[model samples]
Target chain A: MSEKAPWITYRPELKVLDCTIRDGGLINNHQFTDEVVRAVYDTCIQAGIDYMEIGYKNSPRLFPKSEFGAWRHCDEDDLNRVVGGHDAEKTGLKLAAMADAEKSDWKVQVVPRSESVLDLIRVAFYAHQVSEAVEMINHFHDLGYETMANLMAVSNITETEIDTVLESIAPTPAGTMVIVDSFGHLYREQIDRLYKKYAAAMEGTGKEIGIHAHNNMQLAFANTIEAIILGSNRVDATMLGLGRGAGNCPMEILLGFLRNPKFSLRPVIKLLQDHIIPLRDTVEWGPLIPFNITGQLNLHPQHAIKYRKSETKDDFVKFYDELKSEI
Target chain B: MSEKAPWITYRPELKVLDCTIRDGGLINNHQFTDEVVRAVYDTCIQAGIDYMEIGYKNSPRLFPKSEFGAWRHCDEDDLNRVVGGHDAEKTGLKLAAMADAEKSDWKVQVVPRSESVLDLIRVAFYAHQVSEAVEMINHFHDLGYETMANLMAVSNITETEIDTVLESIAPTPAGTMVIVDSFGHLYREQIDRLYKKYAAAMEGTGKEIGIHAHNNMQLAFANTIEAIILGSNRVDATMLGLGRGAGNCPMEILLGFLRNPKFSLRPVIKLLQDHIIPLRDTVEWGPLIPFNITGQLNLHPQHAIKYRKSETKDDFVKFYDELKSEI
Candidate 1:
């Protein structure tokens, strides 16, 4: 792809997906209050966000009804309460929900798009789970919902594995192939290489590339911007980066860089100041050193998250020692 | 220039400069305790940083002795107390200090290299002050100290003005021409353009391009990494990103990225935990909304700094309104 000077003009095809409630819920077991979810939904409308990912479509049996909140399943009533009955035709912004490959009971759980509030169903899966992801996407597509096949933990996957998965996903009904930096380990060069590879693999398939970066090494915004510059049309961000383990790219930062006239940063800033910043006391996320270590090592952030929650959060040296010993 | 994959191998020519005390001092008026300064010095040594900028050579007459601390002037005795003495040959790391174009009395205040502990003199100048900066670099070069001509507030300079200044700097003895993002307004694409511009301007001069970024928009580290990826060898960072309105890139983040076997991150982390984090209580800095606004508008962060100090620090909308009115 040619290096387009992004400042000269805006890319109308570029779509931003705010996954605050869905991703942020992972930090607090999907127990967001109606006020918080409503605030984010309103902010999305005012900020001109393309898609607001309300929550997941996972099985309540797996997550348990009492342990997780309504967002864990995104029951139509719960979503309707937030958006005041999601009228897809009237609402300026579209709604999306995540459905993991193995964890989600898509066959029984996901209803037709005409019957549901969600306009999109993003199917998240690992490299080995591409077949299941394809099935999930086909199912979602047959239901008339825009679908994305998000390959998770991509930094840990090998080149051969990634290529094989891309080939498998090429003919799937999924319209977008997401470059998920699950560990947040890859830097700009890696993002560049991956974007090129994904673009080349999806050539003539009418599929667009997407980016979902974690802020582990504090490069989520940078990585997202890199993918956008390299021609990724879909990007994922969370308000104030409130996802698990250092969070995803902050929506405010993404809006600030997009320079699109339609996107208003003021509402996003207001939401951050009024709603998201207050969550800092109860929720823990951001670029802590342990997270950075795990991100740099291309390891899962689970150990880092556990260490962060432990009483010895300040003892980075000991954590580093333990981490290296495991390696 | 063709894009080279940095992940294939580490850039051996890259040099990391830690300017924690000098930059962080802006937040606390250069009044860092001797203990803190010495701790940073020790950390820099242990962390295997190539250079440590202790402070500035600014004239006390301009800043006033009573108002600013010893670091504002960087008296030989004050520097000697930290380094013990200038023994660049014996010490693995070299000591450096900054000198603003008109703010510093470089001709008389800067002593001969043999009489000082400093191994380098970095002259910071605005676009209009390149002549004075050139003269300062010449004097320092003559005095047997390595020199760098840092063009401050590069995001605000016009393309024509930048060309004229770069042309003027080509003949100077300064071994490094720095792209200083004084306002921190730039994005990755801008950094790429600047790096390419600096590289083309300094072609065949045997001089290296350096990057000094502020964290106003939380892009300092990303911009620094972009510059490095595009072949800027000399990069500046501070511990915990402690500096003015926003701050600089965190040294720990930079060291973690370098991938050099000799660089140890533990020392930087320990210093942050022991020394820098405590300073946050008294000195406010980092990516606040007001600072980000100024950075985005390509304006000096003085007004944002003042707004942050006042009782209305929480009123982001008010600040935005006032900032836009002034703009």
Candidate 2:
């Protein structure tokens, strides 16, 4: 507190994105209705959020069924129908979509090959596929979409691989470089190390940093806090942590720490009441105690998410018996 | 990446206290059934949670609204019945209560106070009454309840004022210091500074740090993450994030991050599915975009919380027009 500025010395001032709908839609198989999507986009616009991701526009031909991919938004035309022609007053809100590296062939991912309904294109790359993602980001960059490379499973990557990838893209004109926690398993220390890595990689380049967090380990919000505090310009979140598996960092939680008041917590509450609440009746996405203990133990929580679903019957005793031998 | 030790590190090992029943009761007027309470207590026990706050134990005699304040197990006898004789094997949980420094008399706040039943007694203190809370913690300590001073609405206090009050609790006995975000408005930097204050004010002493967060502006979980990363021992959350106004941190998110396989995400999911989902059909919690904006603006969210509840057809619309100004 004495020498360095406070922990919040650096944060993004340009714009924010609430991914509750896009990321959260993963939990429900991307089945969110147009009405719900419309309301979400409307609120994002009214709240002055700079971008609202309607859904993934990448062609289904790109994804391999074995890879466990979910298209939070499946159709760009449908997305455009919902948020495309909002009154002129809602102008600055650009639509965005996400695509994985292993999935879509970049050439086929776009619907209108020459024209993009979306303003930005994000390439979410598995750690092993940074090169492919780089090529895609370059492709998007060439296509005039504000390109970004969202490196996934970052905690598992070595510095040498990270350096190779960064050195490749450091000179490219990608708008921003993002550190995406595909597994939502990072601590403040991990984020600090990662932040400095990404920051240093972009040292002389003209680009900003973006963070996408998963809450599988409950570090999503904390990790985001650390990233923004360390000078990252963009932070992403979903409503109610609605993404796949353990979900993404919650947008609502981020609202609490963002030093500004341009956003409203009311619409989020309303969406909870109107859409999110109803979804909870049918879908399940939240934390469990075994996962908490595992976090305490520095273990994986996916097994707990599985165990919870299996615990309702006399199965708990058997599951324990089986896992005991391996656990 | 070369940094050996990060100043702040989020250790997911902290214990989580889920008060969904008690806090959700705020929205539901304490309407939890015995089955629901029993199920939640039992699940948390199997999960190895440290604290299961049954409900408000403040004597109904302390308030004119006795019926309203008697929430869940307010009396020691009620506590015994709800948890079933405090066998460590069954619930394996210690009980806690929210004792108001101003509203609760010592006798009413702590009945049959002893380590045998309730293990922790947290004294909720308004910014103006830290001395009273200190006295209460001292008394509870003498009576055998592990006590803490939960400084509330801390966002309103000046550093100098907090320094004076914290100085009174200097030499804090084991487990007697806390920094509570009553308004849920404090951001990352505020928490960092405050935690530093708490650590400096109680260095070398046996006191442990506790964080009780509100979701007024949706920062509860985020701030709790900061607190944990900065080295606090306990973090407060509620089932489904149920509490006053917005609510507290969602225990599921905490547990999700904890990463223990024994602590199933299912029970928490089931709780949400069976308890919260239907309840949400009638009540709402979570960050609304409008409220997210207000929090972004660094303004109090209570105004938006109030405005959104208006029964008037166009109330929210009318309210939104004057929102950024009224607050």
Give lDDT for model 1. 0.89
- Cα lDDT for residue A7, candidate 2: 38
The whole-model lDDT of each prediction reads: 0.89, 0.66
* Superposed Cα deviation of residue B183, candidate 2 (Å): 1.6
Cα lDDT tens digits, model 2, A178-272, are 88776556766678888998899999787888888776555677677778778787878776667666677776656545545566656664555
Off by over 4 Å in 2: A1-57, A60-99, A108-119, A143-145, A155-164, A215-222, A237-327, B1-25, B28-44, B62-66, B69-73, B80-93, B107-116, B171-174, B216-218, B259-325
CAPRI-style grade of the A/B interface in model 2 = incorrect
Candidate 2, DockQ score (0 to 1): 0.18
TM-score of chain A of 2: 0.83
Clashing pairs in 1: none
Cα lDDT tens digits, model 1, A1-327, are: 325566546788999999999999999999999999999988998999999999999999899979999898988878777776766556578999999988998899988998888899999999999999999999999999999999999989789999999999999989999999989888888998899999999999999999999998788988998998888999999998889998999888788777779899889888988999999889899887888889877889899999887899888878877888899
Highest-DockQ candidate: 1
Over B213-251, each residue of candidate 2 has an lDDT whose tens digit, in order, gives: 776554677678778778887778887677766778877
Candidate 2 true-interface contact recovery: 0.17
